[model samples]
Target chain A: MSDNKSLQSSRREFLGKSAVAGAALAAAGSGLVLTRMAEARAPDQPVSNKVRWGLLVDAARCVDGCTDCVTACHEENGIEQSGHAETDPQWMRKVELKDERTGYQLSLPMMCQHCETAPCADVCPTGASFIRADGIALVDRHICIGCRYCMMACPYKARSFEHETVTKQKPHAPRGKGTVEACTMCVHRVDSERLPACVEACAAAGHNAIMFGDLKDPNSEIARKMASEPSRAMRADLKLNPGVRYQGV
Target chain B: MAKMKNLYYRNIEGTSPGYWGLLGALALMIVAGLGAAYYMEHHGHIVTGMSNQVVWGLPHVFAIFLIVAASGALNVASIGTVFGKQPYQPVGRFSALLAMALLIGGLIVLVLDLGRPDRLIVAMTKYNFKSIFAWNIFLYTGFLAIVGFYLWAMMDRMVGKYYKPAGVVAFVWRLILTTGTGSIFGFLVAREAYDAAILAPLFIIMSFAFGLAIFLLLIMGIYGATDRELSDSVLRRWKNLLGVFVAAVLLLVVIYHLYKLYITRTHGIESFILLNGGVYTSLFWIGQILIGALLPLFIIFTKLGHSRFWIAIASVAVIVGGIAQLYVIIIGGQVYPLPLFPGMAASSSFSDGVVAHYAPSLPEFLLGMGGVAIALLAVLFVVKVLDILPESLGDAVLNPPAAS
Candidate 1:
């Protein structure tokens, strides 16, 4: 008789807790609807020019031997080395620079600068090479034709051709043989309000040399830094207005 | 003036064993070239010497040479029909046939070399108006159509009046086509070697030299094989013309390099090509200057100029030199390191600050040779089927009947 009474009391307690949880959810749902009505935009919209993605690299803080960013990019993009050094595709790489006069040396990662007026886009025969609304330069493989004309046109030499057939590929980054590719600024992660793999890895390694943010927002950290510090674009004489900027070289 | 009725046009009889042997050889070459192309497609471009550093290779050199030569071959018809030169009229039909054959060969090589040959439909349908390559698609196709009409106009007496008009249109079209080809490299601002506008005219002159040299060889070979009598006067005129074109090409090359040397920014590339570029420097001086230009010029201008054999040798030399020139231009242009940073030296795992290396593979060489074979095969087949070649290109047939 005591066991039966204990089971009945436990069932009664569960019913009481369920009633209170239901009431709380109802209230929260109404609040959420009201919040949605007050907002000016939808949650799922296409990328727009209102947000211009940019990267600010602090050369002073960029460690000479740290390859965290390059490693992160390769891992994230599924770029593999084919053991052929000269023919293999490299979307991102670290360049070592030495001062001719003083023998001082520095190292920094180099990639597609994502220029507003990209030469690759201009020379592409099928209009496959294009700049996104958010200023990321991209090649639409559907019509690229693999002529390598865009590769010849790029000034940074940032682009690479897949010389061999590719088997394994990340779903978000589709790479194939005979097409040209370059850095996409991790557009997939950026869409989900997550930092790019390179930027995240740089920070995780404690260097904190790379900053990625919206260049259009004046109050954003990257914009504020650009305004305060005298940063320059690579090959500024080309006047390509690259989205990526460097504070020191 | 009475219309001449004795100018006979007869097709070649293909019953000879030698003719069949020639055809068989060319067929084998085409099959090999196709096989190589298929291998490249299946295995990817890694099989070829081309890399991210050297994007273009020996196949490009061959394709460009043939394409440029095709445009120049049309000049004979233009001079005869459009310019109203009497002596060139007898060879006009053959000239048109040669142009068509060469262009078809070049187009085959270019199409086969594509990274995705299957996507040729996309290349045709999709249009990038700003791109010179896109424009070339139209130019190339238009050339084939115009030349076809020009050929018909020359061959058929019914459309004889259209000959001059067709020739004029074809002439203009070819000039534009060659300019477009040259502009493919010339418009590239990233490469220090190719930015100049002069490449347009330079290519025009190059076509004249290369096209005429091939034409002379073809005429000599055909006449020799058939036991046809080719007059010395006719041969001499062609030799002199070839010599003048070769000299013009040499002068333009000198001017192009000299202009580049004057620019401070281009000094690095200039010095690399003229002095420090190891293999490229030797090719420029020896292959292009000595074997290609000077030797041919010497042979054509000397007492040996009277000999048909020496003239033929001179033509062969010009062709060799043309290949060497294109090699330095196409491959050499890419191997040089791009100056990404103005003053600072750059080092990367990708060979950023150093010169890139390239060596053409067997497949590339075979594919290039295949393009040549395709041209020869086309000429062989067309001559056997159609009455394109005249019975005699002698002075009697060349000059009109002294105005009745």
Candidate 2:
């Protein structure tokens, strides 16, 4: 019995050693492949090579009373208004425009200008609101302390407080009270390699006022737009380089 | 094992079963309020009437008021410790404890209102150096801890003297605590109404008024429950202090507003809401300025200050007014919407551009009520445990059960 037990122990040790060695070889192989892929895709390191997203609204193309984009966005997000009865969780909303001097009426859809350096995240007591590595601004409701300090800090009034009791009956995900929530650049969809809801909505509306592509990729549509068109962010002076850009408002 | 065993079985000395029963009811209310808060936490803030437009709601108003009241509650301790006044000593220890409890109660309620109550530690971790609100968190935490130790030391001295220097240090710390609380709102550059440099000093003055009022009520309530009478000298002196502070607060308020109006006609919707715009106008004019500030001033300044009955009534009035004043400071700032969507035109209606508006929903109201209950229960517990009331009052309760 003692000899048989010794033999079994020796066999187990040999098998464990081989398994570890095999894993190490596979890991090394994958590591080299990943490094090569990264080097091939990497852009040249330049001082201003970082993609600073911008928008140029063509005011002439955007007319008054056209909420095609806004409606599409609401439907796509599946936002419901039960208690307060508002598109209060609007990722995009149509705002009436006025002439600087004469108060001329116009309408334009507004959404998150996922800034390069977001003030909302800076003032957040919890790091719930953060600028992603990819340059999209997002609010992680998981860590937010609903102090509303971000609301005061955001100059564009882009964010909204999701106040009101949520219905337990709805096929909705959990969100908490007191924390600030806002546009996430359709990060969940982006993770799944899907286009942002706003981009899809605008395309569906036939206006194609919005575009989404890897700004870093020179071959992407966003890169082409950046090269050809004159676009501006909503508040350029504050120096928050927003991700979303509006064309021909 | 011993402590746990005693916790369930033991009754505090000098209190009856009836008192404990009342405390139990208050405790139950607190539990129910907490349940509601948990419900909101799991569900979403969408349960409340808050919106981006009116992002701040009733909880914020209550929280600010409680914070202000906490500063005010430190008056007795300040007088007894800082100024070396003997008359205020009777209520000093009790007031310090009350201040800590009230501040804690306020903080817990504020935490319940946060969307991510789970990330409360984040408030401590990610400190925004520029924001007054961020600083307020550290200040409030420090204030609570310091005051708690201060009270504990004072109680220790009464029980068995151990540390004299710690007491001295605590006394000095209370001033810094009050100053920090004042700076929380006073240092805000975001809103025009709070931009006045006079706000911190005004906060100190208001603190005295609020502190004195709280001190008086607690003192009187203890005496009532214990059937004791405050010394005539203690009553008269506190009344004088209350009068002086109220007058100063009134004067400073006038100066602050006048200076603000003079500087900018375009202080945005906040100024309009206070001056010519909406319901807040009446709230500011009547509830805060007139009844809360002026009328209470009249009572304290005149012969009514000498009268115990009138003084008590005035303290109650001052407390109510102080609460109203805090609401004006906090909620008033929120009532106005940003003029971002121009030519979209600002909402002239009080509710228009305001993205979010919330009154205390049922749960919120219950939660607030639970806080009040907790405060009451705390005062009740203290009156029973320590010799908080005067020796004369203890003797009265001991000698006669029913006869006042």
Candidate 3:
């Protein structure tokens, strides 16, 4: 029995070492393939305006009574409701709009439009509300005095004031009571060359209503769709030039 | 009514039981306000009536009224020195002091209502130049400094020569200050309820009305308490001025509404404020128009309003009305949903197309009153130590027999 145990231990050690080496090689090969598949931002490099990220929503394809995107978004951002629905922080929501003349109803997900000239950033007394170089609007919660001026200034009703203390946030997303917050367009995922959780979820659910790409890149799917489709932003009269646009609204 | 060649100033006798009672009451309110602020900070804004929809609730109504009235209070001093109005000269010192007091009170309420009051330092350090809210920091603080200097020049004989120059600066600064205040709302192109340049002028007129009401209250409270002679003739002049200002505010309100009515796109906002806005409509018609504007105007001009008692009543009415107007302007604009889809209706869990409801909580009410208490307490205490009030504002001293 002692001789059998020693032989088995030696064989197990060799197999463990071989498995570790084989797994390391597979990871390296996959990493190289991923690098060629999509370019991710370096850790230290500053975000640049060269890549103007945008989202294109096809209202026609956005199925009514479907909230897969909202669910996926909340899951990805780790947003938990405190049961106060009226004052709860919502990074994204689905709104149903009806044509006044024709009563035709369509539902589209609504979040921060990420306007070029954001009123939230403009009215922020502390400059805490700002649009990133990559065209994502964000609140620098550190400096946010939670004046709610940004909430008042947002035309799309895109912002919500965090009314209660938030605990157990996702590692990537940090939220707290008092400051106003809204959609970040999944900046963490975008920087890592992945689609927003909502966009990926929408495709997975087979609705395929959402499209994500660099708007400045004319060859991108979003740019081509925006050029071909009759997409228009809500409140176009305000002239905010939003990065997020909807088609067939 | 005319200004006396030489004005004599004396400190109020602070030993009176009545004066002590008033001070004690004000101190109580200040303490209560501080407590309310702490409660809010401890729990967060969820405790307040304010939601994502109604961001600026009742505290704003109080704060904006006080701030606007602060700028208008200086109008008295401006009238005396800048316009060479003699009757207003004796009251210039009190006017400047009241302006500072009102501003201090308003700013206190505004700051305490902020979400992260601890980060007030962040607000002071960060400056977004494009923001009118940012511009207001300079306007509010500068008004205090310039007015403080103006007061020193008026009260002290050493810098008496610079009184008129300083008055000119303060006058211009106050005007710019009110414009900045008005523009805070007017520049919000996102909200249809605001976004009008006419709001700037409307605010200036409002300041005149609200400021004078507070001024009248101070005069009556001081002179009435001290048993000083406050003749009806002087009261008559002030009432007439109050009447004119009240009328001007009414006219501007009409014009602002007419402008909104003419624009077909703004029809929804117009309907909200004028017709279907349940609480808002009531406040506008009953609180603002009838009680605040018309009733005060009637009391100021009519023979029935001839007594000192009637003038005080009118002033209180204006004060009440000013708050109502601000409530309508600040909160009313917010309760009406943003015109996101234009003619189209949008529905969401966020109350996108619906009228959001707000009922100001007790803590909010107490917090606002606390601001008032602080202002009143400061003004009254300063009067105790300094010769801010006159020995007499009698017709004889104001318009002497020899001068007449």
Candidate 4:
């Protein structure tokens, strides 16, 4: 009986070792392929100042009563609805406008303009609020003490504070309670050379109102369009030099 | 010198049931406040009235008021030692003590209300040098230290000579401190209600009025509780000074509003605050102007000012008015929608172009009251342990012949 038990134990050990070796081999193969793919796509480098990402919104093409972009942003960012409209965090929203005298109406999506000199970054006490080399304003949650001073300083009112504890957070966007957050312009996707969720969603919905590209790259489609068309920055009087421009508004 | 030699200071016997009851109540309030703060921190600020729109609420108002009053409280010491006013000299020590107490109280509220209260150590360590909030941490701590040294110099005969220099340093430091506080709001160019240079001096004048009112009330309360002899002359002088300070504040308010009204860009904000801002407008006209400014001014300026009861009423009025004024400034400023689109009405899910509503919850009110209780309790504890209060504050003791 003892000899039979030892034989069974040895057989089980051998199977476990084979399984471990197979898993390790599979992981190594994937790692090598991923490295090669990354190297082939672009140099593994930090965000550089060479590329200044921006968005151009054609208000004329933007449809009224459609929130595909807003919904896409919420889903991509994992921003939940807490059933409290007044206190929920909104990274992006559709703003409806009406000219009082003209009776003309317009609809456009508003988010962080990603200014060259952001007021939110200027007022952050711990330097937790900062602008990246690529001119993306972001709050470093590690350092953000949640004073909300940045929200008060924002000219566009683009920032929102996470009032409730966030249970589910997207892997790319780490959100929690007692922190300030805003439209990152989908920095995660931007770094990966992919369009922001909102921009893609807008395009998918056939509005094609939003255009995303590098402002620094003159040959870029967005840059060419901007050069040809007259576009205005919201609250340009503040001299924020917002990356987002609007046309036909 | 003869009167000084005759004057005696002693600690209060804190054995009475009444004294114990008062201490117990204050301690209870402080504990309640801490509990509320902890609940808010654990549950998140969603439990409070503060939101993305109205970022600051009742606690900020209380904290700012206490801090402003603290700097103003030291004015008595400055007048006595720096300006060489003999009559004001007797209250200098108490002024320094109260200043420290009020500052400690205000700072507690400010720190506790933070979303990351546990990261207070981080705030102390890391700093954005350009930020006014960073500058204020240094200003607040420095004010406490300077006042502490000034108090020692005044109380200790060995370092008595240092009193004048210490007083001068503290006076200058306080001016800079109050200026920094005002600049917290004044420097916000995004907000139409702020971004004015006059706000600095306006806050200074406000500090003078608020600080004097609080000081007067403390002195009166202590004197009455101890059954000590307080001169009618000193009370009357303080009353007159308070009247002058109130008038100065009212004048500054008028100028600030008029300046906002004159600017075309700020006209919308000015009209909103003064006319169409429903609760805010009423708070300005009825709460701040009538109850806070006008009634207090009337009490202090009239023959009723002679009575201690009336003077106390005026002090209470001033404090009430001060809260109303802050509410209008902090909450009212936020409720007025930002003009994202000029000549166009904006509507959004984010409450854009609509006045944001705020109703401070029980926890916020308790937290603010806890700050007030902490200040009072500190005074109580200090007086019980140290001979901070004089046995009698009669005219003879206050105005010595040698000092004159």
Candidate 5:
């Protein structure tokens, strides 16, 4: 008698469970439909921007630990030097590199390449991380939940996490923990139609390792330099379409 | 909840106080952990042992170990629910609960280790399909759900009217879960030490060792609480299993390391680091292989099986040793500065320069304490409200048949 009762209860439980599963599936399906509908209704705006910022870095000439560009950019943008520097965003820094083959060494001033198809922005769950209208990948720190998923997603290791709270933070572009940040191509300066701090700094130091301009403008200094010079972006095969390129390391 | 009726408020007479004491201790630790997290959030991850050279430190090691243990804790559940080893069913619910608790603790520790704890959500938001860590997040969450349901079904069978259809689904799911965990460490191509395809199977074995040890301890603790004399056969069975797991883990460690050593190109620095003379050499010998692995192995294989007390001691040693092994695996790899400048020994030395090692800070330790406290408190509250432990009346009277 007890066995018969147990069998009946099991059947009842199974049906109830299957119903819950079916309802969840339906809800998920509807969410997909709603997303597709929204996408269909979106407007097709002009594909071109007036100033599409880009960089051309000359890797061959890059000297090891040359922080000229990094120093200048940090000063201009007022990035904080708090906690572990690597996990915190500095807009620009020099990366010491060593060649595996010939025991050769070089320094690559690393920063956000600002990929055309920025992986960081693409993977953001809340769309809090996005590529701006000005062609720069920036995090809306206000909306950012400080999930460092973007830090791991970037192939270049460009993004940094704010490890601690800061009391002495400069207000030029205030940042806090729990958010992902990286090189913005000096978005604040670009809005004012000024050169990025790193570009200015590199030019000031006479290394000319960096050249910034519009990639679309065929006659622009950046475009001409990029065409004539042997330049490369870090991990180009990633197809991230980086706005920045390396010229001579 | 409906399915968990039998487990509800089922107090194992003698063990209630110990469980409560454990819960109380956990509560205190959780309070400390929360305070630590708040301080760090307001201050920074700089409060921990991590620095630029050693980005991931103690918390990471602990988190990894907890994850491995969580995988291991499924052993009893696997045996009882999947394989239908009726004798092991009593431990299934406890093991599953412990597994879930440990996973939660591990995740908490991992998030605290992050420099940007606030940006932790980014891990979920910015999904890197290629990242093993990312895959682990999804896999772990899924495993928790499966195990949770399986345990619930078992509890229902014990207390409620019937058991849910758990046999095939739970078995298949747990196997995949353990295999998936192995893949997380096994698939890392960035580190040669982890590149061994055998790592997945080895991890599975490690899980068994960790899980079985913890289960035995929990069983003993419960027995103490209920004042029930454990069936001689059950105690013997546990000992036998522990013995087998320890031997297997030890063998795998040997085989895996030896295989790595056999590959000429990979052997030199990596092997020398563990075997010859390096920071890890001492840890490998004293903490992991000797005290943690071999000592526990000998204890279990020898006279320790004669008494529950000795068996418990050996299990604790295994647990401690297992946790230490995780530190060696995660931190050890990072300490060996990537030999990016491979050819010129001079350039490599200068470039790789002796990596400044890391040690966990006060806040990090305290934060870890907080996680443990939460798990303990959770278990305490769960057992309290649900009566997860069976009444000890029969056992208290020293008559097993009377209790039934």
Candidate 6:
């Protein structure tokens, strides 16, 4: 009698799950799912020029050995964790810094920086490297000839070339061999009003080292932090005016 | 009277078995090179030894060498027509042909090495005026047209009068072309090994040495094959000019290194390339300094240098040394670590804060060799079909019997 009762309950559970799956399939096939996806960021809306997306890192808060941000970035972006570090497509990496005179040691995540006048974009022969309207730098892999000139031009070594065929890439991130790539500053997530994976991961890890926001907006958290904190751009001598600012660096 | 008594021009007697053998060898190399390119392209850059740090490898060394040499090869034509050097006049046609062929070879390698060779049309159509590379596209194409027109002026009797004007245009264009090529490296503000005002002028001088070396070998090889009387006086003049260019190259190299050594910021890069960078340091001291500069200078300046064999040896030395120089400049420059912060030590998982390593793979080498084969084959085939060669460069024929 107990076995029979258990069988009946199992059947009921299967049927209920089948009903929900059926509704989801119908919703997907009928374009409802597509419309909801567009609701995150409208398809017809023009990218805002008034906003500049940036990341501010408080190096003091970042633990030297922790790699929560790195883990989050690679996983979120579907970057292959190929054991070969030299050839791997590293969109971002943890950089350890030490001042020779002061003996101060610090570590921070270095990425695209999304400069106002990006050298990568400036040196690209085909205009494949460009700054988006919202001030995020990007590569239009469509036109990147993979000449690696941009790689040479970049001061921070932020860009990476797709050395091998990319397999099982996340649908949200498009990548292939023979083109350049780098941190898009999580543009896909930013488009949908979501925080960057690295920023979220850092906060979740209780480090709260990385903050993502609109640098141009005075009221933004990142902007307010910059106003109050002692933060600076790496390689500021170049006058690239990078959007990614750092503190305790 | 000088025109009436000028040296006769004719197509090479191509019936020789040796000619066929040479062509076959070059063809095989071309096939091998093309196969390597296909494999690399199909498999992606993983098949090659290049990485993000050593982004450019052997293919670039070959391509840049050929391109720089292309400008230098045109010097013969420039001297003949613009400078009115009577001895160089007869060889102008071959010189122009060589210039075009070398450029074609270099460009083929450069395009094929691109991550998107198929999107070459996009590179042509698009424009990033700030980038020196964008300007090179125009410069390279313009070179071919202007030089081709100049060649037409030399060959076609109807347009013969325009030879001098065309030569001047071609000469000026070639200088700018080489400058653009040099500035490709010079314009990079970040690279400690490359970004310098001296690089542009250095490349110009390098072209003179590299281009002339290849030209010397070709002229001698063809003349020897045809059993033509190439006089010692002509050889001496050619060899001495080569010596001068090689010396000038050596001088610039010193200035380049010395200037950098004076700048403390560049000290790390300078020491790496000059003192203990292993292969790079050896190539700089031995390959470039010894074989490329000193040995060639020794051969061309001494009493035995007048011999055709020694002259030929000097030319080959120069060629080897030229490749070495370029290898140091292109590959060595890349392998050095890029300093992001001047006063701080930095490390990253991205190969930052470390000296990068690069080894040329077989496919990359083959692909580069294929470009070289294509260049040589073009030169060989064109000379056989056209009246590009003068009948003889003997002192007797060049001087003519003093008209009574």
Where does candidate 4 stray beyond 4 Å? A1-44, B1-5, B401-404
What's each prediction's TM-score?
A: 0.94, 0.76, 0.94, 0.92, 0.74, 0.92
Candidate 1 per-residue lDDT over residues A1-249, each given as its tens digit: 788888888888888888889888988998898676444234466668888898998888889878899999989999888799988888888889988777888888888899998889888888999998888888898887888988888889989998899877899898899889899999887776678888999999999989999999999999999999899998898898999888778
In model 1, residue pairs whose N, Cα or C atoms come closer than 3 Å (at least 3 residues apart or on different chains), thus clashing, are none
Question: Docking category for candidate 5?
Answer: incorrect
- lDDT, residue A49, candidate 6: 85
- DockQ-based class of model 1: medium
Q: What is the DockQ of each candidate?
A: 0.74, 0.23, 0.69, 0.58, 0.10, 0.60
Q: Which stretches of candidate 2 lie over 4 Å from their true place?
A: A1-49, A58-60, A72-78, A99-101, A115-117, A133-135, A163-179, A188-196, A203-249, B1-25, B28-32, B118-134, B158-204, B263-271, B341-358, B392-404
Q: Which candidate is the best by DockQ?
A: 1
Specify the poorest-scoring 10-residue window by lDDT in model 1 chain B: B1-10
Model 5 global lDDT (CA atoms, 0 to 1): 0.66
Global lDDT for candidate 3?
Answer: 0.90
Q: List native contact recovery per candidate, as a fraction of 1.
A: 0.77, 0.43, 0.83, 0.75, 0.18, 0.84
Q: Residue A122 error for model 3, in Å?
A: 0.8
A164 Cα displacement, candidate 3 (Å): 0.8
How does candidate 4 score on lDDT? 0.90
State how far residue B75 of model 5 sits from its true place (Å).
Answer: 2.0
Q: State each model's C-alpha RMSD to the native.
A: 3.2, 11.1, 4.2, 6.8, 19.6, 6.7
Residue B104 error, candidate 4, Å: 1.3
Docking class of 3: medium
CA shift at B202, candidate 5, in angstroms? 4.2
- List runs of model 6 lying over 4 Å from the truth: A1-41, B1-4, B400-404
lDDT of 4 by residue, B116-173 (tens): 8888888889899889998999999999999999999887889888878999999999
TM-score of chain B of 3: 0.98
